[model samples]
Target: DQQVKQNSPSLSVQEGRISILNCDYTNSMFDYFLWYKKYPAEGPTFLISISSIKDKNEDGRFTVFLNKSAKHLSLHIVPSQPGDSAVYFCAASRGGGGSQGNLIFGKGTKLSVKP
Candidate 1:
């Protein structure tokens, strides 16, 4: 089964702290990993992504680490701000070979940042 899983349903952190979200996958064929962030009543926005070929990818205050051998991935946000409060989804899919962008997303982890 091609399934993506986010073990934690939610997380809470104070401003200026670090927040981590974890995810797991069972499909060995997946080659691309992505993290999307969503706000209430809004669609998810692409945050960052890492190719299966790489171990890590970073963008601004966000970082993603992928462990292909372990079929696991994580998203880390540092100095979490009040604006960072939102739901985060972990997704995966097969690489560019005619593969439509139909992402398999986890239920999502809601991150709440306290001011």
Candidate 2:
């Protein structure tokens, strides 16, 4: 089973600035990594993901980066706004032989974008 770790419990960013959330994993065999954002009483929404074959992937204001050797990944949001405040979780899956066919999630980092 793949385990994801997000050491930072919370992050504060000023509006118009950048927010950087990090994630680390114990499994080197993880073939896929994803970032999800969650709001109160709402299900987590997929943000971005990166494959083992690629070091980075970007979509709109979000970007995901993967460092295979270190088994670490990060999500970056530029021009952070108040609406961007939410809990962000990092997930990983080994995806093939030993996978549980589900994503393993980190503890989640709460982001607060102050105006």
Candidate 3:
């Protein structure tokens, strides 16, 4: 069974609108959560992250919120732009003693922002 899941395979939003991507995890051991954005033909790049210690983290136009009790997380991109169009992957790790890059990722949700 997949530890992390992105139920929505795709999302579409208009430019200047808010885009929200959702993710869920089955593993309670996950303490670190991250979101990655991938453009066509390019490797996924880290977008935002939130630690279990905090319920939310924000940076610029992007924000990540985590709900430990529900094992859920979400990524929000405000005023979405065409440049924001890409596949977003949700990832989680147990952290602490885990080796580097030891993360479980979701299948990814392709986001298309239209002007």
What Cα-based lDDT does every candidate model obtain? 0.92, 0.91, 0.95
Of the two candidates 1 and 2, the one with more favorable TM-score, higher being better, is 2
Error of 1 at 81 (Å): 0.5
Q: What TM-score does prediction 1 earn?
A: 0.93
Q: Please state the error at residue 102 of candidate 1 in Å.
A: 2.3
Ranking by TM-score: 3, 2, 1
Clashes of 2: 0
* Best prediction by TM-score: 3
Residue 93, candidate 1: how far off, in angstroms? 0.2
What are the root-mean-square deviations of the candidates from the true structure over C-alphas? 1.6, 1.7, 1.4
Against the hidden true structure, what lDDT does model 1 obtain?
0.92
Clashing pairs for model 3 are none
For model 1 the local lDDT of residue 70 reads 93
lDDT of 1 by residue, 13-112 (tens): 9999999999999988888899999999999999999998899999999999999889999999998999999999999998554654568999999999
For candidate 2, give the lDDT: 0.91
Steric clash pairs (candidate 2): none
Going through the candidates in the order shown, the clash numbers are: 0, 0, 0
Cα TM-score per model:
0.93, 0.94, 0.95
Expressed as tens digits, the lDDT of each residue in 59-115 for candidate 2 is 988988888889889999997999999999999887665446578999999999999
The RMSD (Cα, Å) of candidate 3 is 1.4
